[model samples]
Target: MPAHLSYDVVIVGGGHNGLVAAAYLARAGRSVLVLERLGNTGGAAVSARPFEGVDARLSRYSYLVSLLPRKIVRELGLRFAVRKRTVSSYTPLGDGGLLVGEGRTRASLAVLTGGEREYAAWRDFYGMTRRAAERIFPILTEPLLTRDELRAHLDDATAWRTLFEEPIGVAVEERFRHDLVRGVVLTDALIGTFADAHDPSLVQNRCFLYHVIGGGTGDWDVPVGGMGALTDALADTARSAGAEIVTGHEATRVDTDGATAEVAFRTPGGPAVDPTDGTVTARHVLVNASPQALADLLGEERPPAAEGAQLKVNMLLRRLPRLRDASVDPREAFAGTFHVAEGYEQLATAYQEAAAGRLPTAPPSEIYCHSLTDPSILGPDLAGSGHHTLTLFGLHTPARLFAEDNDAVRARLLAATLDQLDQRLAEPIADCLALDAHGRPCVEARTPLDLERDLRLPGGHIFHRDLAFPYATEETGRWGVETAHANVLLCGAGAVRGGGVSGVPGHNAAMAVLGR
Candidate 1:
């Protein structure tokens, strides 16, 4: 063992959240050290050029920015840039598609539903959610509120009952009569959560709340230079604040005594060659790993099972696929999220199939053209050549489906998912795919198991674990990031009000350490 190094605070996992916490603590003149297992930081929020001889940068795992709090962005003075999509989403139906955007939503819905009733319902339903978002989003930055306190803060019994008390499926079903419209509303509930829309456990409700209330606006924007830009900005902010960052260092164990916490880590190469280990003792320890990872580090029993239920696919396309509906331009349809077989019944069927340990015959997925909104992701040569990038997020494909024969399962799932996507396109999507210098198509799919192996996410749970209600539970007056140990705190997506790229947990963890 080497000599014990000490710091005022030590953050495990150099994800955006950990970096955020380190920046805040270090800015306050507290000595801080950040340990990251990967060669670079960013965790899931990373952008990479996966294809050989390809200039397109893809946001590999987690894409889009919705849940990031603006308060943190402003306070940190980070230089991250995100571009808002002019089109929100475009879901294809029989011959036309349902288009949802900022200024043109009503007209588009009227055209899709072919009537004013469903359009009126859409307006009313979103109106309620907007009001709910206004009331709920502000509370996420504060200390955890009790259930009753949150309800009281909402101040509307109907809004509370619809959003908090009942399953979100109930609200979706009651509000919309059209299956496609209903599915559009329910997709938010099922994004990273592996629960039925009607799950009585209200897991879907919790997911829905985060999706809608992100940044106090339900807009999911694309980071200009790819997701890595956000993390890079965060890293620069932390370094500017005088925080020490050590990459390729994995925290093996965390021991907390009454007075302080100690973190043992293996540097760069494992213990085989580098037999000696390093230790950092700190007054406060902020963990950005999943709860399961934390439990393992603490040598405690595992927490509840966490399994991510989404398959991510990234592809570089030679050109945008032609839409079945020629009336709408391919650029317009692909600019926002393009839904493939994600209707209400279709999503439910896929969920049922996946739950039964079978891949959905027609996977419910959505695709977005990153280059359509921001051309900076591609090299000037590629952009001039009309090349584009597509990111597909397949829902209801849980981690369990890929448990055995991961490659075979991924192949089958990818084929089926692309087939479903092709159904909506005028030409086969594969035909539009670009080729790398090695003559292989520029495409990659990541299953939950792959995510676990690559990103060290337990069971590939994206939010670290299932997202909890932003407010407090029975743990009274406790900060959301507080763990059972006094010196140790969860500053990752597993913490309360934690999830997405918000960095709320990191902020809260630093506040806890500051005794605020």
Candidate 2:
């Protein structure tokens, strides 16, 4: 609700990406305005005390950070930081397990496989990906690189063949022999994607690359003070740079004629703008929403809807659950990704079962503790009492499986998923749950359908759509943010190199506008 009708740029969706664009554009002296439909900014990257009177702030959605660039943090001088977990992951296998960090990774792998071959193979495979990350992560911020250009720049024919030319399953099969090890490696490819190991379409490969290339080390870091800390910092930076961000205003439609455009929005309770009623005009329209939402806003034909394939559960634990694998401490296992029934065969079976329109009999998931790395999210009272937060991410639970009856399917799947986790625990996780002020358990489960209802994510697809390779396609304009309209750009996770918590698309959109 600004009286001014014309502005330099009008951004839709005040998510993290939109805040990045707003901060960059405003710092460059552009009159920028951001419209958000939610009551607060940060979109999915916010932290909330979801449990009543819990005295703990949990990252409600999109927890953890791996892809966010340090360049953005430095450029904006945002007061946000991340803490690294000492352990990378722990995969329970009967009485033994595989722990991948803290100088015991090789020994743990040896125990799991009964040999050192798997450990060597793991080292070699990750070494290749580490190099690829170093070379490929830089391209995300620059202009779009064509497929051939990127392949040649990588300079590793083997890495290209393993990652780009063939399915990730091929590489997983060729590089690793153990079923549990293979599943551990392949889980990254299926985080938010609904694809098989050998899906010829190679969506899993793109997802895998994004996951491994984060921070040039593939290590997912915990955002200090929760994920909302980063978005809050970005919002503060944008505001200080003179960008006006208006929450509770939804951009309904956009009418543009290439050079200049008018953005129409719905304001629940605010005075209208001048000269054009509820419309605001700008030289460029940068949409920080999904691609499907952009097409709808532009009144164009919508693309195929994307389906999300993950189940998220957030829980507050009075104490960490005891593990059946006594060789590893519960603290060490929960500190990193705790693999639950995610063996390679189990994952394949789950994917096939879900593809055939049923929930996986043995659901595959991974759990990690957020408060283990940063106890500050819990106040003095909660932290002093040994309280912790656990986030469980279930795989292969696609949106279609719950289309018939979301609540019923969610309940069934939640029970099955927790059962799988309990198999590896000495005691039930439910027994370790903390109670909120209402005397209810401090645990909540969200299916893909629930995400759509809450976040406006089309079909609950977290990336907004299937992630594309970080290369130029036929539709990829100069910066990979451009649309058919010269003045329109995508600044959200829907952009070509966009996904996860990364702000590449937003930075690229601003760069395109600056002609840099």
Candidate 3:
């Protein structure tokens, strides 16, 4: 083994969470080193111009931000900014569509459901969620709360039943009458989660709770200058706090004694034959990789089976596609999330089909045009040239579907998804696509398999694994990031209350190390 380079703490994986932990720990005067396998640090939260010679920079994998706590940003003094969307979402239905935003909700709800009843119900439903958010969001950064303790903290039995005891589908069905409205509400429960809305397991409820309780506001804003800006700010914060960040160095193994952990890693351009090119010893090790990845590093068995359930597609458009409903402008419809064929029945059908090992006839997906909100993503020449960037999130497309014949399945799925988008547009979306320098349309699609290969996400599960309810289960009063090894802690999305761009897990891991 090479001579050990030591530190007070070593963080595996320099993703946003790892960077957050590094910043907090280093700020407290702990010598910290962060090792990232990728050449860059952002992991899934990154921006890139995939199309050769294109001026448009797209947020490739993880698109929006909602779960990030304001406390982390404020404490870390991160300089990143997230801009709110004036329009929340627009879902096309037949010749008309529902546009929910500032000053548009009432009329859109009336049009979709033919009355003001659904709007009133929508407000009521969100009011309940808001209350739940108030109780839950505050507890995320603290030590884990037992279910009984959490229920007591929640206080209201009705809110507990709605969010914890029952499936989220029940709440949606009981509140909304319109299929489109129900689907819009249900989409929150299904993002990155592969489960039926009505699954008896209440997994959808867990998913829905996290989605709506982000920053206790439930507003998913776009990070200014793409997602990379957020990570850049995190990296800068850590570096400013004296954290050593080493990119292109992948941690290969973690060996720990009762008091210290030693990490073995390989640098870029090193010989592939040898697993360990260097070694680092630390008083504490924070793993920002997935649980399964960490288990592999420890030469232990893998964790429970988890698979990602979304297809991500990115495209640069020459011009925005005209909406079938001419009443609303294309820019308005595209500025916020554009839901395509994601009605309640549509999502259910797609889920059923995908669960049965077949692709949905009409894929359930949503899109948003980043340029409409932040034109800075495009170069000066393309800023005013009618060019825009579109990001799509397709639902119910699990990793298993692409396990065999990935390319063919991805092609068919993409075609179906685009066709579904066409149904709501005045012109074919493909016709509006911009050409890359290679004379090909500027479009890219990523399946679960693709994400696994590129992002090192085991099974491409975005949240690392299915999100657990944010309370403690086995370890009472302990930080959720605690692991079996005394000197090792989980600081990634796999940790409890750990998904999304939220730095709660990272912060808690640092707290554990600091014994605070």
Candidate 4:
């Protein structure tokens, strides 16, 4: 097929991680080919003009780039731009009032508790655990490991303690002044995990902090134009480095002999014909999509099943929803990201519901207004800018979205969000202009079975296999890239250290390939 074009490496997904790997490999003088499903290359990190003259990043879909290493930015000279913004949270009260919290603020700890004693308790809890992240951040950017290689980084006692002992949540709670702060700090624990926030193996907090500290807490960065530009820069870098990135090519199957693997996919412009059985032989294959997608590609070649799933929803709002503090300007409020957990108890309950496959009544949601962070998104005048988008993550949706009667669930999620906004903003619903659901229209809806059919991940487990359990411990933390497969590497979100914008999968996989 196509004259048997061969390369040293063939990357699937064209997502940020795949792009990162392709760029690095190409720079090292290896020939590479990057395949993407969407017309655009960026996987989740994409931008589109939803309305005329008003551009909003699908920012809410997968916002922020904290886990992305600053060193990689400099080394690649990847023209991606990021504005350092703080992280803030507001819980709207029914009384047209708001409660605010910050990463390192005493005021934030106060918001989490009802009194001084709890605040002191929370402060201590947060301080001790903050060290957990500090200790692990520098280590994630390195290569994956073998058991012996992993042990080289850990002293015997630390290794033993991490494996057989230590509870992640309780360990974190011991450092914070308020339960809410502990929940937020521990929130990272559930990003791709199925465990309860307060579950045992407290060292998981260290894993959470590892990702947080990699980007530095409170330093949320915004792409200059939209998230799409970041992906664009990556694509440009890959192209400049001599990698061929072909979009609109949907991979159907990965045929493998005992030694080499070949990807089969379809190019666009046909009358819905089955995928062409083309093949690319490579010394190494890097999958940048979710683990669930990869599992499907392998068919019976599944990794041990990992529980839990990632559900994302995007909404186009008539206007920004009002929150607890009406006095806080929307611009200042939008400077950082926001979440919808009133306190620790509420957050814990939400996480539990997600694990149970029930949509939490008061689902924990992330609200990001990219237009506020990057002026380019808004028109010449920002106010009354009817065009805006809000991405809700950590949202608990039913296991099935396409099933009949799912509208009831959607309505409930919408109503709860609207009620919260009305109470928080002191604003009326009449002011809202347009509405769209990303799940129904953008992601799960448009790309039905995409996570399963293409990426081969389980239940669209977007964060990769569960790493917080076995991967987070001291003994295994150093095993960032080594998987059980030979010549087969772990180069997705679930790779050691797990998830976020860090590009560690691709970076670490590259090191493994280069034997660096």
Question: Against the unseen true structure, what C-alpha lDDT does each candidate score?
Answer: 0.88, 0.93, 0.90, 0.58
Clashing pairs in 3: none
Q: What is the TM-score of each candidate against the true structure?
A: 0.97, 0.98, 0.97, 0.80
For model 4, how does the per-residue alpha-carbon lDDT over 1-516 read when each residue is reduced to its tens digit?
Answer: 233456787787887888888888899998888878777787766676553433344553357677787777777788878876654554433432222445445554344454466556555544443443344455666644444544454434442343325665555554554545555556555554545654664534434545445553424577777777777888899899988988877766665653567777777666877545566777777767655556667674666754334345555555665544655666555455555554567767766775666667675655566655565654443335555555545443433542344446556555565454455455653355453333222222211123444344455555655554323335342345554444445577766655666777788777777777
Cα lDDT tens digits for candidate 1, 404-489 = 89999999999999998888888998899999999999999999999899988888888878888877776623778887888888
User: Which candidate leads the pack in lDDT?
Assistant: 2
In model 2, what lDDT does residue 117 have? 97
Model 1's lDDT to the true fold?
A: 0.88
Give the lowest summed-lDDT range of ten residues in model 1.
268-277
lDDT of 2: 0.93
Error at 30, model 1, angstroms? 0.4
Q: What is the lDDT for 275 in model 2? A: 30
Cα deviation at 410, candidate 3, in Å, is 0.8
Winner on lDDT (2 vs 4) = 2
